[model samples]
Target chain A: MFELILTLVLLVIGFVFGQIAEKRHFRSIIQREAETRDLLCFNERRIPQDMFSPHVTLVCGSVVVSVDFFKHFVATLRNLVGGRVSAYESLLERARREAVLRMKAQALAQGATSVWNVRVETSSIHQGQRQGIGAVEVMAYGTALVPR
Target chain B: MIVTNIEYIPGKKITQHLGMVSGNTVRAKHVGRDLMAGLKNIVGGELKGYTELLTESREEAVRRMVAQAEAIGANAVLNVRFSTSSVAAGAAELFAYGTAVVAE
Candidate 1:
């Protein structure tokens, strides 16, 4: 009975540590900061905002995916374990959603109401040093429009 | 290797397909300092890397696509388009496409 309890405790601790480690790694991978040159407007005492054209080229964002990643890692595991792959699904979906959000922000900053002719793409990337190979990337982009 | 943007330009042939390209790679870094800037963007801060990569890759891929166009007896490419895929972590594929055309 003691041995069984100890084993269970160890498993819980290990799982917790794994969650902590994975969270850090995932956050690092999902970099959601903006760039200066991509800027349209901001409040600052120094530089006059009018100097730079408020017209910003909006972008929804991009992603690199490996179907095998979902298949082998998440999907396969879910199939074998009979559980949901919510964590993995959220990563992929968030990337797409966040990208579009950024574009919307850019448009808003530039006084644009809507974007036009948006383009979204998914492409395969088979770059592994050896043996196992599979991955995919999705990129979303669109033009920002400003009224004259 | 084909571009949708080039379509707006007249006298260019639009290729519906992207040309075959290999080793067309793009690398971006979120250096510690860069991350600070990005975090700043959270509350009226500046985000980094996204635009630069977009502009850089677009130009590079377009250049490559243009070379392919020249090889195929085309004068200008129209309706240029851009795409990116991660072939590996730390390495991304940048593809540009446009219609290859000789002046009609």
Candidate 2:
């Protein structure tokens, strides 16, 4: 019985570490931010922005999470459905955010100011349900536009 | 990431760009989620760096893009493109560009 308990504890610890490392990896990829020159400007229009802003996006191919989202989710879900949701949410959100950020980074590299009509789309790699070690993806994309 | 209402509308003069457009700090939760996705790339996982930044930057970009397009009296945007660059170590940029045209 003691051995079993110990093994369980080790498994949790390992998972936690993996989570931490994964977090670091995401941070590094999206380490860059918006620059003044990289800002897309369209000064002529009148329509305002809505949906989610000052927002961040990441797309893979499935689900995605942002730092704020994952943290809040982990805390809230932990209080509700325990931490089992951690692995699923963690992977999904992470991929989503990374994919979105990469799109932005690519835009910036192209000497564009901003990307418009931003969105993240998700698609499953394998058909059928995403159960038991199945890998899925969520893609984040938007128009890289220049301000008028 | 495909955005809605960004194309030229028959009655509307130009496409409406909607997304996150702000000059504020990105939260930790969002960043945390992004990191997890980055790690997945190791095993031929999808890289999602573009999605996050695009989503965040699109709002601002669209806001400006629309404003400019409107100013130019453009009714539509076509063949858009995205671009980015390094501002600071932890900061980057995302931009969208397209031909602002006056489509009936």
Cα RMSD to native, each candidate?
Answer: 11.7, 13.9
Please name the candidate that would achieve the greatest TM-score relative to the true structure. 1
State, as a TM-score between 0 and 1, how close model 1 is to the true structure. Answer: 0.44
lDDT at A20 for candidate 2? Answer: 72
lDDT of 1 by residue, A21-123 (tens): 4455356445533332343422121223333222324344554322222233445458787877774465455445445555556566766644555665655
Q: Model 2: per-residue lDDT, tens digit, A50-111?
A: 32232222111122333332333344457875646564565666676566656666666555
Q: Fill in the DockQ of model 1.
A: 0.11
Per-residue error (Å), model 2, residue A67? 17
**By DockQ, who's the top model here?**
1
Best by lDDT: 1
The residue ranges of model 2 lying beyond 4 angstroms of the native Cα positions read A1-17, A33-84, A127-133, B1-5, B9-104
Name the weakest run of 10 consecutive residues (lDDT summed) in model 2 chain B: B20-29
True contacts kept of 2: 0.03
